[model samples]
Target: MIFRPIVPQELNAVLAQVRPDPSTAVSADTVRARLADGEYRHRWIWVAEPCPGRAPLAVAIWWGSPADAHPSNLDALFARSDPMWAFADLRRRTSSAPRPTTDPRSAVAAALLVAAHRVFAVDGLVPAPDYHLLLPSGWRDRPETAASVAWRRRAAEGAGLRLTAEQLRFERAADRPVPSLSNRLSFTPEPDDEIFVDLFRRCLSKSLDTTSTRKALRIGAEEHARDEIAFYRHGTRGRRSWWRIARTTAGQVVGFAIPSHNSVVPVVGYLGVLPEFRGRGFAAEILAEATRVLAAETRGGVIRAETNLSNHPVVAALELVGYRDRTRRLVFSAT
Candidate 1:
């Protein structure tokens, strides 16, 4: 039978039954805090009804928009759990279920995830969501790791989610000197959203994330550019003072950079160089100036950045400015 959204009275009981992992069990206090603080709501929590009135065998809870949740929320809730997640609308989400080591119980969890997608759709969210797996550094070519990945891949396939792209996250401490701010490209502050989208079109490339997401959303280049700019209009977590467009001395657009932050840390929102201006090594200066602006604002905190694995040139530019690759993520979308 399908699950129902849990009510506040059942919050503790349902949370108690959710065992996401044997190693990282989420505490009731933590779940209560997140819920009471409004990180999630009754609708975002689902429970399987194996029968009419008996306790649920599995549960799925989603942390909705405001973009992110505390990273440890899931693992601690389930004690060594590796929850599958997605970006259904404006935020990242995951569902808690019994580990799929056994048959009927696993099926129940997968079904619940499918159901949650339908729930998210009511809010105009895309059917696809991202399942995040944070890998340890240097986790390549290991037989056991490969086996684990294969198992997850099969399970996701069964649920109609496809593995699309691999991403690399780069980070640096703010104390790192941003390569000297540019003298060639003038900085334009507070440009209209239309202007930013137009400039982004000049920088869009064949990115794995961009490609898969475009197909999933079935949007054209211009629409996707607008979405991209909207994701980083600056001031999501910090001030709008950090947004800038790089233009030539004559005020022609050359590139752009957005330095923003999430709930956790300062981030390089978007760094792009126009196609006609590529290979001139202009992105370094653009990014450096953005970083310099944010670093000053953040007072020497860590700065975060990410790019698709297939987008090598952008990756190279980030490295040139001293961004260290830290984590690798695989994005899965429900087909």
Candidate 2:
């Protein structure tokens, strides 16, 4: 098979070949919308074809901020040897499909990812972009869901994308009452971005965020903090003034909250409590304050946030503050 980026003229044919899967939520309309909005560029979309003149067997779509020089994440992946593969075909082959053997789709997808990563690296994008696969809540408990995810997981791992973090996605609708907050902590906007970086670095001491913690371990805390600050500053659509440092009424800095937005919707950008202030129930307070800030500004639109599934404290805080569990996101990255 030949792996390469798709041309603009081939987009319609390429999209027509893939089957829709709700788990990935990568429908043609959605792909078209993102492409139109600059989140998905032609160069970021790759495919594996039998030959130069044939139809693509698999397609990989990457997503990035409009301002980003390179794509940040793999949003959708679809592969099938048969161009007609769909729900009917999947249902017909469900019982006969061999579980132990590697799926042909997986093989093609792996080749596509490997080729795409090499090109991205040649262009100076080091450490391949992460691949995010969204699974339903309790997906592991469902046999069909588990089986479907297995092939994609194998494809990702085969392409050197190690399973890094599993996150619990949460969404709070505008109708959900804004969580109440106590007067124990006061939030004030800091004009300096450096102050937020220092606090972000301090919070890393006992952070449960798998991605950031791993980054700090690999590149040191100081640089990791600066990387994160720059990401939020330039990559996201959120305004800088939305950031606030949370402190006790006595002027003791407890934590910070960032009420931010993405290209799609508002999000609880980031929040962390100081190590010394842990176990004082400040996380919920800080998160609630961020939610309030976003709600007022967005005029009660939906706000989303995510936390590492292993981070029980943050998970509990999110639950307590009225954010409903939406889905589980499995992130794979090349280390």
Candidate 3:
């Protein structure tokens, strides 16, 4: 087998061989653009050659952070390829200087861990003691495996890590009673400016409980705000773009939902209700309204969202509206 860096010319070939469908957002062109823009630093696109007469296989996409530059990111593009084998390949490429373990257990899991370690290594990155893998609802009820759990823990400990178990909660849409409210909240799409900023600040202030969680969520929200604004300002190439849905009541801005057509999935960039509007089910209402709009725009697809696991209210609100729990993203530090 041979491992080599992919060049711009080979991107289309890589996508053709690896990508599930030509319409996926993580295409060769998209990755190349990110690499060109310096977002994807210390990255390697690897293909595995078969022995003798077999066709070459696109094994994995390993991305690393420039700061740490650990060969960690490995996504098995070919279904026939074993993830563990790809992980071992990455391990061989990494320098043995007490480097953090790159996640190869699952697609992109080890990659993200390595990336975080690279960025926050100097700041003493702490792993979650034991990582929690959220299973789709009902996967836990029929479980019977100390051996399985032990194996997971052994893998982590062997890699100088630990593992734990926890239930991940998610919202799924179901026919439910909608609360009655007189606010008459409506969504109006517009550019994210001072008004949206203020709305975000207000919502975060009310929603986040702990000071640390608040601060972290605030930073994330701010960054997302900027990205949404940029996407709206300079529409993404080869994509449908939109910035609509502002929630207001009694001539006062309460909340808003920013939907864009940049990816294969229509993303809800930002959605929130001011502190003053809490308990009135405004958050759920706005999300439901956004879902309606998205359904109208697209035939049907999964709506992706991420929130700190600690935020119970937002999680509950999402459930109230009709989003399902997909996966729990475990973020770690290498330092």
Determine which window of 10 residues in candidate 3 has minimal summed lDDT: 72-81
- Which of the numbered candidates is closest to the native, going by highest lDDT? 2
What global local distance difference test value does model 1 have?
0.62
Local accuracy of candidate 1 as per-residue lDDT tens digits, 1-335: 54567877777677667543311234556567657756666766777654566666557555543443321111111111222221121012234432444324334556566676665666566654555554434546666555444544444554556645677888888897777644788777865778778777756653334643455356767887876676565326666667898888888788888888865688887877877788788877887877888888896468888888887777887898899998766555553
TM-score of 2: 0.91
Q: How many steric overlaps are in each model, in order? A: 18, 0, 11
> Candidate 3 residues 1-335, lDDT tens each?
34344556656655565543311125556566656644343235544443323333433454433333343322223323345565565456544222334333332233323333344345553331223333344433435333223333333344344323233444333233334333477666564465655555556654653322333464576764554444444443212233444456557777776554433355444567777777766767776666656555654346555556676766776776666686553322111
Ranked by lDDT, the better of candidates 1 and 3 is 1
lDDT of 2: 0.83
lDDT of each: 0.62, 0.83, 0.46
Off by over 4 Å in 2: 81-101
For model 3, what is the alpha-carbon lDDT of residue 20? 38
Error of 1 at 207 (Å): 5.6
- In model 1, state the lDDT of residue 174: 89
